[model samples]
Target: MLIKHLIGAAVALALGANTVMAAGFASLGEGLTPLGGEKSGNQAGTIPAWNGGITQPPAGYQGSGKPHVDPFAADKPLFTITKANLDQYRAHLTPGQIALFDTYPATYQMPVYVTRRSGSAPQWVYDNTRKNALSAKLADGGNGFTEAYGGIPFPMPKTGVEAVWNHIARYRGEYVVRRASEVAVQRNGSFSPITSQQEAMFKFYDPKGAYADLNNVLFYYLSFIKSPARLAGSAVLVHETLDQVQEPRQAWAYNAGQRRVRRAPSLAYDTPIPAADGLRTADDTDMFNGSPDRYEWKLVGKREIYIPYNNYRVSSPDVTYKQLLQAGHLNPAYTRHELHRVWVVEGTLKSSARHVYSRRTLYLDEDSWQAAVVDQYDGRGELWRVSLAYLKNYYELPTTWSALDVFHDLQARRYHVQNLVNEEGGTIDFSQAPPEDSEFKPAALRRRGLR
Candidate 1:
């Protein structure tokens, strides 16, 4: 079986040769045609972006087909990063970055296959649905099916995982079956259920098993584009789950001007992130508070996915967009139209990558692409930290991604929680608005009490 899978993978590699080379430097803007902006085409008169083979219409008009198309349309990604290209791309990464990808291929290299669905909602919507389904599955016990190397139990129940996997598989199957059916119907003007054989062809193959060598290729590709920058004034709170009551645990980003990590403001139920300089402090209490200074961050990617908010799905009809966005729970502009493919990253302390728990692994959902789940280990390589993000859905947004996220730290028995829902009477619009620069600043930490 493995041999057959390998042979099939080799064929795929051969077929994807051009795509692999194209992807190797796609970040360099080679062979792509730009669109929807002032500069739409390249010097050779070809579009600067990949338009999925759709031709643009006259000025001020949208494409007759679909306005929103898959960015990776036309060509499929070939061989993901493996030992073969590790050295080739290693020069472009930091040592910590290198170790992050090298740690796990099974969880990271899971191939995200795209099925072209016509009359489908925008790519962002599909992206959200996929993520939401995955989250729902995890919450229900999908995490239990597979265990990590160190006997770390999966988080969810078998039933939940099966249900969620079925949902995801069905969605993917429908897209694939529908596309094939559409093509056939287009030619013959008739319709029928997809054949079992056809379905088998798509379902039987495992991208992870076949392409194990190419794990983490997507991260490398994303790094080539725009990497995540640290939010200068952003304040983040890591909620620790002790025996019982959730307290106003604190940590703050250091505002260099004030030269301190002061005690951040205690967040109300839900508050809009204030402007960057609304509060500034030079005291450790104001910044980091009393928390240990043993963590780091990196922006992977952004996409729309569901989160837990207000005890139910915020994106559902019962809730209003006005309430969610005002309280800093939802940002329609950044998440609404985004089909984010997130980064699979790791975080470790400054002391050493070889701490008692050598490393920590994080899987960040692309849409509302926050770090949703974290897997940590102890110095003896035993699984120690299991953090889960309970997300709330933000309805008014185009995607069903989360607006509020609560992190559960299993080992430390604490919780790190961050909620972006709007505060009452906050003057932010739910419509398309860019994220404020201050929202990510260190000073904002002191004001929000999220440090």
Candidate 2:
């Protein structure tokens, strides 16, 4: 019998609570979803049970290397929530959502669709998750984790940091290559798209590898600008470490104008993303990423909220950017919101730490551990930014990920959206052979740039 106090003994001692629990394969697939969510639906029966979520592609899907076809295309919105109806749905909406209604009373709204439990992973991933449930443990004061690989590390997390770790280490396939664009939409809705080709090798989820083989590196990422002649040929490479406190993330950038490659140490934490126009920080990349050492995480329990889910329309090749991007946010006509149970985790900056966001509340989907919505606060403890991840299951890979990520600056009245591939010939490709480790080296980055 293996038992561990999730969030670590130090946190439990400080919080003065005994949260120790036993973990094994017995609870998985029995009392909990394969990935650790509640197996049953909500009391209202709006959200359905996890009946082995979309393990196969829809009938109309053309297969890999194509845009995913919406399985719920025939479903209609149950209702819409605008500024006028906001009060009625206030209990189901996040504070950031309410602020959006107040910020753009006329345009910003939520088109609530039927909830679909379409989050899933392969059978092997489920098996690995069960293994991780028994082995994974927090390391170096919640900065990272150890003794887990190939699946979610903390399937049945007992603390906020453990839940956050699950989000950071969720299964994202072994290798993938995607071509997408990012745009920082201004107040008037005018913007220039910054397109790029990105690739990632999830070493932590490598099917052929084990925990002992990780060597602290979780994944390798490389991105090169593809369009807007001025930024073309520029590239960035990153070696994301699992234990960041022990070894910070190693990053390198290739500047096309300078024709030189240099180490990029400013790619972590609160550093403002170059093309983001200061709307998002570097750690805000995948909803939330990097180290968790700067903040105190608290598990605020669960809530049934309307979060963006199964949003195939927003990622459709048929929807043009001009028609999708509105002045305040993405056109509500294409966004799909559904009511589902989510785990709410809050991160508050430690009094001694320094960062732009003083506090952040993250709502993660119970089934997938994906951050669906995040409300960020400034130093004055005022709402400053809101981030949403439009989630959809890539049925072919049998995994759910964000089709588009939108970061809104409530104060500036502008937003930035990324991972737009509506016009791209192909989307994410997980079938590609994994690239050599050398490809992520600084020398390779310089070589790829010169080409």
Candidate 3:
């Protein structure tokens, strides 16, 4: 018995050592490193990198019009990449472009928590937190309160004509309930039940209010992408995990010159297609960020680390930006927490022969597989564009990821931004996406006056 006990102790110690080593060197591949400049930290302050939790209350925390505090204030970033010394890190890039990392550290830093194996359902995490003091105020007592008080029991997808019914059901079910809760809270100075439709409508359309809160849950669902089969004639929704209704919906790329939207073709995994002008066509499509056809995608890899989102941190992103930078541009954000786990991906024109940017680099959140930041290059190998997408959780939908906002930068001083929301009594159904080729044509763009 004594001998056995000694052996067990020895094994336990060995295992603990191994785990520590593994965590320290959890690289996605040969080139990628943690968001920090060094793999490990020293006595000096944590290496400067992007810090997401630092922003003030109104800027960082959202929901119930309440403010939340940052938990990792001590772990703030120590450094960031700049115009200087960008060349020294070129060999590490898979897409070969330098992007603005510090400008949006939450988007660039890989998340490590995503890689942590959690036996608990993602919904339970939020649910349990809500039952606690901090999050309890936001909890609507689960499905019962949501249905009896909030309005709709379930969220409907945002899409087409059939969506009209979905909107009505949601309005009657969830929206009504939410408004009641809000009015009761105001009138009695405590949580009250919604009693009227007009009150609900007021809450539904009020720009300063929340019609529906569904960001995290939606992202949780979207994180389930796992080698889904490619669709017929439908562009492969590659890059981030495909978990949302808006994720796989077909899209038409708008051709401004022709004043039309063309149905984009789906390309096989890693299969390159040549463009008519010897350039490559952007091959991926989906609904986030304007529409599909706005960008192309290439599979990178899976790995682990910390990332910036709301108040918590996670690990993801396996690829690095070493290969995708111009000769001398630097990444502005380079904090420690942002160097968590991630899946590095590449997006470019199908054929390498012709493209405004020969290559683009994307850092996808490993847990959610959502594209956080993208760096694009010009034909002359100059850094041209940088894009960022923010993910928010959805409580009602449960297990899905949705974009809160999207931003883009360009050499020609052109830029774009967008925000998404689920409006109360609003008619938007994403579940039943239009038939594959139905709305993705030149005539469709003209009819909608988008072109």
Candidate 4:
């Protein structure tokens, strides 16, 4: 383990002694729903509780690996939230979301849609998550895990760290391959496509793998940039691990310019991302990543809020890039927000932890344990960046995840939206099977880079 003491070892420092054994499997049926969502929806009818999620495609659906046409394309926005009516919806808006409107009063807005609780996983996954609730436990100050694999580690989460762990360990299928683009849109709405072809093997989420089989690895990722001559031929390979205390994340970069394969320790924590131009940090890639060792995570309880949901529209081939990318944010018309209950967790930087973000709060969707909304704060405790992820169901796998991820910088008036493939032929090819282990190896990256 990276830390000398685990949460189970130092119960007093991690969580109160009362919470050490808080979430027993008994709570799953009574208070918590089977999928870890609240059994009952909110008191108001605005948000509906999750029943059986969207396991099949809508009417007129094409086969997998094709473009995902929005099922709700005909639906209209229930209402629009803007700077002019900030006071009316302050209760549902995060500090970061409100800041965006304040910064770009005329441009930034949110189009609210009706709530839809339609995201489900395979039967084996739900069974594994239930099993994990009874067996999984934290290690080395929440940096490692024991007795968990192929499921949400902490379905009945009792603390903040556990909630975040659920997000990191959430199911996203065993493997995937896609052609996508990331655009760091400038203030004037002009941007170049930092396009790439990417593949991942979610070994930890592999249904057949057991906790003992993980060996501390989470997933194997490879990204090869394919656009704009300046950044082409550069590739990154990451073997994300569960426990940094045992073995930290293994990352390597094959730089076409240098023609070398070198170990990359700088891909974690506060390091500026390679192609983001200093707008985002390495750990900021998936809303929150790397390790939770540098901060004190606190479970801030649950709340009902409007978040990005069922955003298939943004990924539709019919929607052009120009219509989606705005000066400060994605065109609000294409964005869809709906009310959902989420687990709120806050991470405050430890005094000894050296990182750029002092405090960050993540809003995790209760149904999927996905970090739907993230508010990252600077050293001065001021909100600096806001991230929103629109979740949609991959009907073939019956898994739900981000269709588009937008990271906005409040101070710079710049942002990046990754996983955009409207112009690409296929949105995301889910029909492919798990990749071979050799494909993610460092030598493979070199060969692929040279090719």
Tally clashing residue pairs in candidate 4: 2
Per residue, candidate 2 scores C-alpha lDDT tens digits across 1-451 of 0000000001211122234444334568887888988889988999888888887898888877688889999999999999998889999999998999999999998999988999999999999887777677788988988777898888877789999998999878889988898889999999888888888999998888999998999999888887888778777888888988899888887888888888775567887886788788888888999899999999898899999999999979999999999998999999999998999999999999999999999999999999999999999999999999999998887898999999999999999998998988868888888978888788888888787
Tens digits of per-residue lDDT for model 4, 1-451:
0010000001112222244344445456456665578766788888876677786788867877788757777888988998999889989978887888899999788889888888788888877777777677789978877887787778877788888888887887788888888878999999877778888888887766777887788889888777877778888788888886578778787888888888765467887764665677777777787788898999998888889888888988888999899898898877888888888999999998888999999999888889999999999998999988888878778877999988899999999888899998887776787867888898887888888
Candidate 1 stretches greater than 4 Å from native: 1-19, 23-357, 366-369, 390-401, 411-416, 420-451
Q: Write the per-residue lDDT of candidate 1 for residues 1-451, one digit (tens) a residue.
A: 0000000000111223476433532322123111001112324332132233222222332221112222333333223434335665554233333333354222222111221111111343233332222232121112112211110011111221222222112211110100010001111122111111010111111222221221211110000001012222222322211101122333333333354454444332112122211111111111111112233333232222221211223222334334333211122222211112223444454463223335555544322233444455556655543433333222222222223332222333222223222221121122332233343244443554332
Q: Write the per-residue lDDT of candidate 3 for residues 136-196, one digit (tens) a residue.
A: 1112111111111122211111111111111111221112111100010111112211111
TM per candidate: 0.27, 0.94, 0.33, 0.92
Total colliding residue pairs, candidate 3: 85
Per TM-score, the best of the predicted structures is 2
TM-score of 4: 0.92
Best by lDDT: 2
- lDDT, candidates in the order shown: 0.25, 0.85, 0.27, 0.79
Instruction: Name the regions of candidate 4 deviating beyond 4 angstroms.
Output: 1-31
Segments in model 3 whose C-alpha atoms lie over 4 Å from true places: 1-298, 302-308, 311-337, 352-358, 379-382, 391-406, 420-451
RMSD, one per candidate, in order: 23.8, 6.0, 20.7, 5.1
